[model samples]
Every structure is written in C-alpha cells, then in structure tokens.
Target: MLTDVLKPEKTTRKNAKPIWLMRAGAASELETSVQDWVDASAFKAGAGTVLVVPDRKPGGIAGAVLGLGDGDDPFVSGALASKLPAGDWFFDSPSTADIRLASLGFLMGAYRFARYRKFPEERPSLILDGSLDRSELVALAEAVWLARDLVNTPANDLGPDGIEAAARLVAKDRKMSVRVVKGGELQKKNFPLIHAVGQASQSAPRLIDMRWGRRGAPRLTLVGKGVSFDSGGLDIKPASGMRNMKKDMGGAANILALARLVIDARLDVRLRVLIPAVENAISGSAFRPGDIYRSRKGLTVEIGNTDAEGRLVLADAIALADEEKPDMILDMATLTGAARVALGPDVPPFFTTDDAFADSLSAASLIEHDPVWRLPLWAPYLRGLSSGVADLCNVTTDGFAGSVTAALFLQQFVTGAKSWAHFDIFAWNPVAKPHAPVGGEAHAIRAIFAALRQRYGVTRN
Candidate 1:
C-alpha cells in the first residue's frame, strides 16, 4: 500500500542495464577493470565514480561500471553515487543478493534538505536486479527522507509544539492513539527534568506519546531526545557551537520516522514512541548548571552542565517508558560530542547491557546497510556520574568519556525494561555527499528498525 506512491517502471530493474561496481586499490592489484573503463573514457575514476562504457559489439550500447572508493575502504562504495551519469542503473552481480545497502545508498544519495531553497535535479536511479522486495526499499527510503526533512527544518517551523503536532498527525493518519503533557501539565505529571530543561522557552515543553497495534503483542518502546533548539541554557554555548542548534531534535525525528515505517508495514508489535520536546533556551528562569532536579524516575540529578540537557529530557522519557516494563526500550539522542570523537558523524555509537539485543542490532545493521557500533555500558564509568549532593549528576565534570557517562547517566533510570539500548547520534551532515546534501541526518534509525522487525518477526502481506 505504501509502495503505491513509488510505482516502478519496467526499466527500474538491474537487467535493464549491465553495471559493474568496481573498487580501487594499489596499482599492482588495480589492473584493467571498471576503474580502467572510467580512466580510458577520460572520466575521473575517483571514489563514487560512474563510468559508461560503450559496447564494442556493433549497435550494442555499453553497460556501466560504478567506481567504489579505493578498495582499501569498501564502505566508501557509497561514494559511487556521485560518479554515475544522470540515468537509471543497477548492480550487475547476482551473488551479492542483499540489496539493502545499494537501496540505502540510493536513498542516501537522493537526500537533499532544501526547505529554504530548491533541490538540484537528482541523478539517475541505480536499480538493483536482485529479488529483494522493491516496495520495502521504497518505504525505507521515504522514511529516511522524512526524518531528514524534519531535522533540516528550522526551529521556527519545528519547535516543541510543531514537533508534537507532527507526531499527532502521523498518529492520526495511522489511526493510532496519541497523548501530550504540556505546560503546567508536565509539572503535574512529575516530569520535572523535562520541565526544568524546557520551561524557559516560550513554545512550552511537552511530552509526546504515541501508541499503536494490537494488545498482547510484544511492547517496543522508543524514546527520543527532542531538544528543538539548544541555546545551551544558562551555561551558554559559544556562537559557533549554537549556530546549528536547531537540528538538535534529530533523534525525535528519527524515532517518529521509524515509528511510521513500523505502522506502515503493519508490523505485529505494540509500539509506543515518546518524545520529550523542549528548547534549551536561556532566560532568567532557565535551569542552571548547579541546579538539582527530580526526575520522573524519582532520582535527583545535579545539572553538571546545562548544555547536557538532551540527556535530562531523555532520562524522564526513558523512565516513563521503563514504567511499562516494555519488551524493549531504545532511546536515541544527539547527546554528546564525545561520541563524534570516538566515531565520526557517519557511525552512531550505541550502548546496551543486553548482549542478545546488541548482537541482533549488529546483524540487522549489517543487513540494512544502516550500521551502528556498540560501546560498552562499562560499570566503571558509573563513578563519573556521582554527585556530591544529589543521587547523580546529569553529566560528569571530567571531560573524558563523556558519551559513555551520558549513556550511564540515562541507564540509572531504566530499571523496569527487559532490555535497554541508547544511541548517541550526530543526526547531521556538515557537508554534501551525493543524494545526502549538507543538513540534518537520521543515523542508525534503519538498523534499529531492522532489529525490531527481527524481534517481532514482521509478516509481509
């Protein structure tokens, strides 16, 4: 049903054109291949190289060879998207049957968040010849694009209330139930951490909850940090640090997008999405770094830094999710710079105490081409969050291991869930790459969705 929007043409198949995806390496190993075809034709055969070779046989049009980056790093194969000429193309090989990566690259290449401006014409499509479900691929692409668009929008258009409205719209469209605790209601609800971080913003802080699916199905709870704009509260970020803060709610966008996919696919699981939307703005009433606040989990947290507000809101959300003792609890946040240091913008780092859940995620990530690496919820880092006056600190004073400590800080409130995982995502692309132009990005969303599918055994119609 979702695939109706992306009706395929007969030409959108691998056999439509013969294309070879080539990898480059040392000259010794890089003899005549697709790379040679690119070089011979005078086309730059660097990473993301797309070369069209004319058929030597009379009247036959030459097939194509997509140049992956230097063979040393295969992941950059996605770079080939930039090199291909504007036309439809597909992978030539049948042995590499898992076409999800190619599909992912295709969508990633097509992404351009040009809300303020117009997007350039998209390059021709690279069709996969394999038997993988075309409809699923289209749905996945649409979901990722949806997440990116929501992230790329300015805070003026996607503030806390706007984000809640979007969630409600999605819920209404899907015939799901939705609830929101806003303004004074958040205080009544005892979401003090959520209130403390967002009270200064005029838009008002709110907790968005959306639920769908049949009763008795395994519960899958997703919590996302929704810091719509991080002005860094009273602590304040330097001008450079705050420039792109509007993209701070990327985690919220990602969860909502993933939620849409699950509902669209009619997955056989009870799903709940929680987004604590807020703006970490500065005002006389803004929460301060030294302030102590009570969390929904009943834990007292000392504000180690106002800039670390993402984790604070996420803590309250995760705690509320844990109250349900869901089968799985996964929380996403653009919560730390330390994670970016450990792994670049492309690779999101996740931490979990459950070994089985981690392995499932690892396998799903590889299969989906939306990979995430696991970091330890190493208990030793717990000491970093100790507070002199409160039960814990929202952030560690020591600059080292900030990501790990942030994960650990959130973990303190997750007692009821059977399994819990935290994803520290960058949710942004500083520069353009093929279809994914510079703007907000949705990292690790696909992988987690794949894992959920495996966990619930999604049945196709």
Candidate 2:
C-alpha cells in the first residue's frame, strides 16, 4: 500500500533531512555553502537532477536538493521519491512545490506492485504537511494503488470470479453492501449480453453491485466494463494485439478504486457501482460473429465482430443502472483502440452530453494533475451503429470514428439519467513516468473524484 509509506505523524521530525526543490538559475536562493556545494557537484537544478551534500563533522549525510527545471507540474516532486536515499524527508523552505500535490505525488512515486516480485530494499518515506488531509491523501493514493495492483495481475490469477472476490474485499473494508448475480443468474436477471461474452470461459460471468451512503442522498451511479481477458473471442486478435489482454478488466479495476475513494472520503451521495465481469475467450460455446442478442434495455444488437466485447457487457450493466434513472451515469471501459490513437494512452478522451459536468472535469483535471481530454459525443455517429438485422450493431464495418461510435452505442441505453459520460481509456501505461511506472494505471479517477467532491459538498457521514 502506498499509504503505508506515509508517516503517521504529520509534522516534520528533527532527524528527518530537508529536501529543497530548486529550478534552473535559482542558485541565489541557496545558502552560501550549499550553493558552492551544488556548483561543485555540477548540479544545475534541471528537473529530476539530485544532489546530496554530506555533513563534515558527523560524517553522515546533511541534506539534498531536487531540480524542478521549470517546475510546470507541482507534482514533479514525484521524481524524487525513488531518487533520494532511504530516510524520512521533508520539502524545505525556498522550494516552489505545492505542498499538497507534492505530498500526493510522493506517495504515488512510492507505489510498487510487489505481489509477484520481491522488493527487499526499504524505500524512503515522507513526513507530510499537517494542513493536508492525511486521510484523504491516503484514500486517493490507495485507490490508485488498488487499481494498479488489480490491472497488473495476469488473467491466470484474476478472472471474473477473481474480480468479484476483490470487490468483496472492498465491500468488507469499506462497510458497503455488495451482491452478485453470476452464471445463469445473469441471464435470468435480463443480462444476456454479459452472459454471451463469458459463456466460453471456464470462469463464470458475474454482475457485482455495491451500494453505499444514505438512501436519499444525491444518487451517483457508475458502470464499468469488466472483460477479464479478451482473446478477442472467435474473431481473435493477432499475437501483438492480444499480448496485454490481461488488462482488459482495467475499467472495472479503476471504477472499483474510485468507489473505494468515495467510501473512504465519506462523500454525501448515494453511490452504486455495477461491474459486468466476463472473459472473452475462445471455445466451442463462444458467441460467434453475426450472432444477434437482445440487450437488457430491449434493444437488439448484432455481433458485427467478436473482439468488440467490452461494450457488449457494459451495455447490459448500463441499462440496468438506467432502470431507476439515477442522477448521473458514468461508464468506463478500455473499449477502443481509436481512443489511444486519438489522444494516446497518457490522455484518455471522455465523452459527455452534460456541458457543465465536462467543464467541472476539465477544471478538476488541471488541479489534480490527472490528464483527460473531452471528445464530442457527436450525434451524427449514431447512424453508423444502426443495423438492418437488429436494432443496432456491436461495431461498424468502415472503422471510422471507432471511439465516437462506441460511445454512441453505449449512449442508446442512457435515456433515464440526468447526465451521462463515458470514458474510453487505454488502461495500460506503455512507458514509465515520474509518478507512475509502466503498468496498469488509474487515469482520470482523481480528477473525477475532485469534481464530484466540489459538486456535492463535503458533508460526510
């Protein structure tokens, strides 16, 4: 847990070393001896550069300096988490970092998915600022850590049942009520699409629903696509495309993480989370291309392609969420490769008809340092989803506007909500960054949480 690396006591200890954040051409701010030492060590204070000075009398270390180059992102302090020596450290005076963001970044930098590997070395920990909400910070970091851990785990270890088990753990830890409809029960419950996707896998498909907070509070519902493993079903993905199918369930992992954040923060809202867990594997019983199925919302869908399975499971779950017409609907899925091509993996593009909520998310994304771009929910793309055989098709043949069409397909079942937004995310991080490693990542949840907090005042239970 990244939160474990945070010192319980919020004040800086006397024994802890001071870490000064400096930028290029900031030599005048440093003390005379420190400035001379920095110059002697050839430290120009570029971003991610580190220089530690030694104490002459004690023969131990004195303090260290971190270069922030222009320091555009306050969370740039994340880089220092693994760079500095193992010990208690604090950001010192004459530094430019925002204490709260830097502190959060420090925790993020300390994250490691050590479930499979052995990490014998003790990592550095921070004495956090007293003014910051310690509990909130832990909740934020732990939410992201939980998502990363779930996504990083391979399919052999985490299937639909594995996802349900993890949700049970969250329910136990967060004092939430959870119920599941698995196997044939999903079909009886009007979730034929979810069953169709997972019928081929040995692990049964499931619908995991978790609820929390007061009954009359503002209703906020979330739906996530939980394709445990996508061998691309009968259509099949090439070896390169299927290499990282283990992360197909990243949307479920992330939304569950967000649920954890909501419960931990004790937000004043009635929260409901729905995850349609399934594995799109090949077998004699797998749903084949050209198969037509009726969705929970009574809309018929033609299976144009078997690989486009994430949205299939999500459609049924979103329809179920719309049954009661909740205040808002937000569904997340690693649903399209076009999203990656449009905005790349680092910046997930979001679609929403609610302009005000989109603005809120934009502002929150900037403040929280969680990057997300708003893509239009173009109504014109709806025609591409139309089918002569069924009410709609799972995918289009032309392959143009893949992301937009996918979002439009999910929007068909969202008539009852006050507002609805969809996120097409590439959950896997292809390269390492200062705050995160190259693995499964929690993309825009922080920004979304921040927006929700501002929207609904913080009157926690």
Per-prediction RMSD in angstroms? 3.8, 1.5
In candidate 1, what are the lDDT values of residues 1-461, reduced to their tens digit? 22322226455453345556555552422336645656677664456666667666784445666556563333343554555555666666544542455555655665655667774465655564546676677767878888888888889999999899878877886878988999889999889999999999999999998898887788989898899999999889999999999889989989888898888888888889999999998888899878998888889999888999998999889999999999889888999999999998989999997898899999988766676999888889899899899999877777889889989898899998999999999989887665467888878877888888777876433
Please give, for residues 190-270, the per-residue lDDT of candidate 2 as tens digits: 999999999999999999999998998888998888898999999999999999998999999999999888777778889
Once fitted onto the true fold, the runs of candidate 1 whose alpha carbons sit more than 4 angstroms away are: 1-18, 25-39, 42-45, 54-63, 70-87, 96-100, 120-123, 126-130, 459-461
TM-score of 2: 0.97
lDDT per model vs. reference:
0.79, 0.87
Model 1, 178: alpha-carbon shift in Å? Answer: 1.2
lDDT of 2: 0.87
My TM-score estimates for the predictions, one after another, are: 0.88, 0.97
Clashing pairs in 2: none
Residue 397 displacement (Å), model 2: 1.3
What shift in Å separates residue 291 of candidate 1 from its native position after superposition? 2.2
Best by lDDT: 2
Model 2 is weakest, by summed lDDT over 10 consecutive residues, at: 90-99
